[model samples]
Target: MTNLYRAGDLRTPDALAKVTPEQAGWTYSGMEVFDLAAAESVTRVLDGIEGVLVPLSATDVTVTVDGDRHRLRGRVGVFDAVSDWIYLPLGSTVEISGASGEVALCSSRAEVRHEVAVVAAEDVPVEVRGSGRATRQVTNIATPSSFEGADKINVCEVITPGGNVSSWPPHRHDGIGDCEPVNEEIYYFRMGQDDSSHGHPNGLGMFRVYTVDGSSDETCPIFDGDVYLIPEGYHGPSIALPEYPMYFLNVLAGPLPERTMAFCDDPAHHRIREEWTDEDQDPRLPMTSAESRVS
Candidate 1:
């Protein structure tokens, strides 16, 4: 068996983005999906790691961390908008209930333990990243600028509309060159309904990963609930089909003393950044407005 894993190649449970540390040959990062019906839930306590519970297709959930409780709400399917999340420190037991949909649990193995904190849906910063077809909505939920109190995790959400691209210009956080910090990343993807006349599959997209030295390269087909692991590479230009929207959750961690997402663009394609300087960012940005939620 090769080191790379594909969608169907990795057998998993109802929860997706399933990858083991041994399978990745890495120790600091882990990603998984957790789903429960209304009033149904599960409890977990990872002794040496901090975790982030991100709701994918959800509206409400009650999270109890070591007996402290926080209620989360305002979550919808991937195509709709951003949602709420909960973070738990190491060695702490977590009980999640009233979860109405699927939630992604992205954990990082760490020794530092912080208190439990809840990030509400409204507080999440939504920005339009890239321009033109490369345009997409970014919900900065757990990045350094968004949340703290975690030892080794930096998470963000990206939504690439159909016929557009995100992760463009091919960048990498694998090494320190260009002052970029090295980090391993995992991408969990979801696609909206396909409205093509050809009767295409719903929830499908494209992803490319390659080493700068040309040591290896891969561009694979991805679908809803599929996962791609980036141990080291310049990964980019994740493109959705012509008629649907693509959503992906990014989880990153590394050996650096402080957690930060730093990456260098491929020299060959870096000039494109300059070309888009004068262009307007896509008009479809800020995908969700305050109107979606009523007081």
Candidate 2:
């Protein structure tokens, strides 16, 4: 009936690994955030699903997928950090350990066991979406159109600067049609600092979910570490609280083998998409060197 979750409300992983999809009332989709200290490690077994390890704030680390070992670079924060990910195929055992920091193990049920590939941070293509206040940075790292290793997942992230809105024009990817793909989505949020806004050190943001057929709707507060589920409905206009930048990692999957980012924009609010045509992209966007271009 609802699709919003606060950070502390969601189930967290153990000291090493945790699955979040089932905890959020979802099937075969979610991310596991694991923390490790210098020279520490943990092992996770994937029986029927695949895992993608995204470096959140890594320090000298290595993710061993099956038998291959992949090195990792350290990042201070998600906002200004680059991208690096290790892909784990089904029926494989992954051992992750390193100097210190955190990483998100994004997973989804997969029947096909693809080859393991590590996507380096430098290769991530960051682009600008929308214009003016709606402007946000997009990093299409493992989307169906981008990465080919994964057989079922379509992952991406958006970064909205303080006081801005992204995921605008209310869109949905429910049911198969021209642009619709019967997919379920999860939004894992990470907020940047705002000494002028909230007193908490973690940071704050907001997101809205409203049904299209008058079924239901609600807006939820977002803080660092929050995750929201979008089972069905028109969702959009996620807000970054004043002075606090917002970042969200999107995990998507469906019945189809080929994944995509296609969706139907709410017709009632579709006009707003074209109205910003005259304005320039917000200068605050493309917040990091990981960004490649804008479209």
TM-score per prediction, in order, is: 0.90, 0.90
Against the reference, the lDDT scores of all candidates come to 0.75, 0.76
TM-score of 1: 0.90
Count: clashes, candidate 1 = 3
* lDDT of residue 97 for candidate 1: 75
Q: Candidate 2, residues 192-216: lDDT per residue as tens digits?
A: 8852221135688778888766768
* Clash number by candidate, in order: 3, 2
**What tens-digit string does per-residue lDDT give for candidate 1 at 1-295?**
1234554565565443466566788878887776677337777787788899887776777778888888877456665556878888888998877646777788888878888888777788888877777778888878888888899988888877677889999999887455468788888777765432111246678888888778888887777667788888789879887777677888998889899987888889999888887778877665553224111
